[model samples]
Target chain A: AQTVTQSQPEMSVQEAETVTLSCTYDTSESDYYLFWYKQPPSRQMILVIRQEAYKQQNATENRFSVNFQKAAKSFSLKISDSQLGDAAMYFCAYPNQGGKLIFGQGTELSVKP
Target chain B: SQTIHQWPATLVQPVGSPLSLECTVEGTSNPNLYWYRQAAGRGLQLLFYSVGIGQISSEVPQNLSASRPQDRQFILSSKKLLLSDSGFYLCAWSVRGRRNYGYTFGSGTRLTVV
Candidate 1:
């Protein structure tokens, strides 16, 4: 069984500041992939970033990046220069053997101006 | 560019009524289609996925069922609606053998069963 865990239920950050959302996962598969998705107030699920388990290099997409520690089974997302529009719920996901994703509970982020 | 479409952005149905939600993908063929449900303030739950037309794999056991009548069309149906079925339903797709790319999701449909 693969499980993703987002320990932080809610987080707040001031505009232009940086905030890090923590995520941990358990998977027996040696080679796999991970993803971060954002669901805003509009209720649309958007893909944020992706990281390959075999790559030691972290993935960065403009203002979003992930610190993936394969040994520790940790994958954390860092948002730089947070803006009001960045407020949303974030989910960490891992795929199962059949390609079905197992998602974390999610972290609701609020940006304070 | 591939795009996914889900219909009936919002729906309110009475309990015991039959239900059908349609999802279609454009600009892609033989894509893997999936149905997921999300409760308020919760993560997504995978309901069903299809590798090809008429090949459906159910992730969870429930009254809700899914079908893929065409290459890029997936339908979610229920013989009878239940209050527990009320939630936001999302449709997603990924390229075959490219699951690492993640899924492209639809805007989603909000269903409310009374």
Candidate 2:
């Protein structure tokens, strides 16, 4: 069974600053995908970014990026130029080959305007 | 350009009452559907997933059940609701062999069992 762990339960960042949320997972599969999802006050889960295990190059989307270290089983998300809308519950997820999406406990992100 | 829809943004039901939550997708076919639940201050829990019409896989054992009556439609139900069942229910869709495309999620349903 694969398990994603987000050590930080809550995090805060000043608007326009950067924040990084840590994530680690336990998986034996050589091929897999990692994802970061953000759930806002509206309660909608939105995909932030994704990294394929085979790709050593991190993935970047707008202000969101991921630092994926396959050997260390670590996948962290970095948000730059953070905005107030960035405040939310951020989750790290991994989907098994069977198509089951496993998630980390989640980190609540608070932004100071 | 696919979209997912999950309804009854909020629901309040008494204990032991029957429960039903519906999810539907548009602009896609033969997509994979999933049901997830999020308890307060917790991670998302995958409840059920369907690869095709009538083919549903449950990830957890509980009082709830799921059905896929149509290719893009999935339903979660319980004959008798339990207080533990109270949580935020989310529906999502992904391409058959390319979940890398990311899960397009619904707005979610907040279910409260009294």
Candidate 3:
């Protein structure tokens, strides 16, 4: 069984600053995928970024990027130029070959203006 | 482009009442469907997943059951609801491409059992 762990329960970032949420996972499979999802107050889960296990390079999406360390099983998400709208519960997820996502407990991010 | 939908957005039901939640996908075919439950302040719990019609896999033993009557449609049901079953229900799907990608989730259903 694969499990994703998000150590931070809550995080806060000032407007225009940057924030990083930590994530780690336990997986026996050599091939897999990592993802970060954001859920706003609307309760809609949106995909932020993704990293392939075989890819040594980190995944970046404008302001959202991931530091994917396959050896350590660590995948962290970084949000730059953070805005008020960036406030949401961020979840780190793992998807194996079987196609089911194993999600983390989630980190509630608050942005202060 | 593929999209997933789940309803109703919010539901309130009494204990021992029958429960049914529906999920459907559009713009895709032969996709993998999944049902997940999230307890308050917890991670996603895999309830069931279907690779094809009539091929459902159960992850956890519970009072709930799932059915895939159509290729893009999945349903979650319970003959009698339990208070512990109250949580956010999410439906997701993924394609069977060469490389596995992240899943696309629905808006999610908030089930409140009284």
**What C-alpha lDDT do the candidate models reach, one value each?**
0.94, 0.93, 0.91
Tens-digit lDDT string for candidate 3 (A11-103): 999999999999999999887788899988887889999888888999999999998889899999999999999999999988766677888
Chain A of candidate 3: what's the TM-score?
0.97
* Lowest summed lDDT window (length 10), candidate 1 chain A: A93-102
Tell me candidate 1's fraction of native contacts, as a decimal between 0 and 1: 0.72
DockQ class, candidate 2: medium
Cα deviation at A6, candidate 2, in Å, is 0.5
Evaluate residue B17 in candidate 2 and report its C-alpha lDDT on the 0 to 100 scale. Answer: 100
lDDT, candidate 1, B5-106, per-residue tens: 999899999999999999999999999899999998788999999999999999889989999999999999999999999999999999888769899999
Interface RMSD of 3: 1.8
Question: 1 or 3: which has the higher lDDT?
Answer: 1
Report the error of model 3 at residue A9, Å. Answer: 1.0
Report the lDDT tens digits of candidate 1 across residue range A53-105: 99999999999999999999999999999999999999999877787878999
RMSD of 3: 1.4
| Clashing residue pairs in candidate 2 (N, C-alpha, C atoms within 3 angstroms) | none
Per-residue error (Å), model 2, residue A4? 0.8
Report each candidate's C-alpha RMSD, comma-separated, in the order given. Answer: 0.9, 1.1, 1.4
Please compute DockQ, using alpha carbons, for every candidate against the native two-chain complex: 0.81, 0.77, 0.68
Give the CA lDDT, 0 to 100, for residue B5 in model 1: 93
Task: Name the candidate that leads on lDDT.
Answer: 1
TM-score (chain A only) for the predictions, listed in order: 0.98, 0.98, 0.97
lDDT of 2 at B27: 98
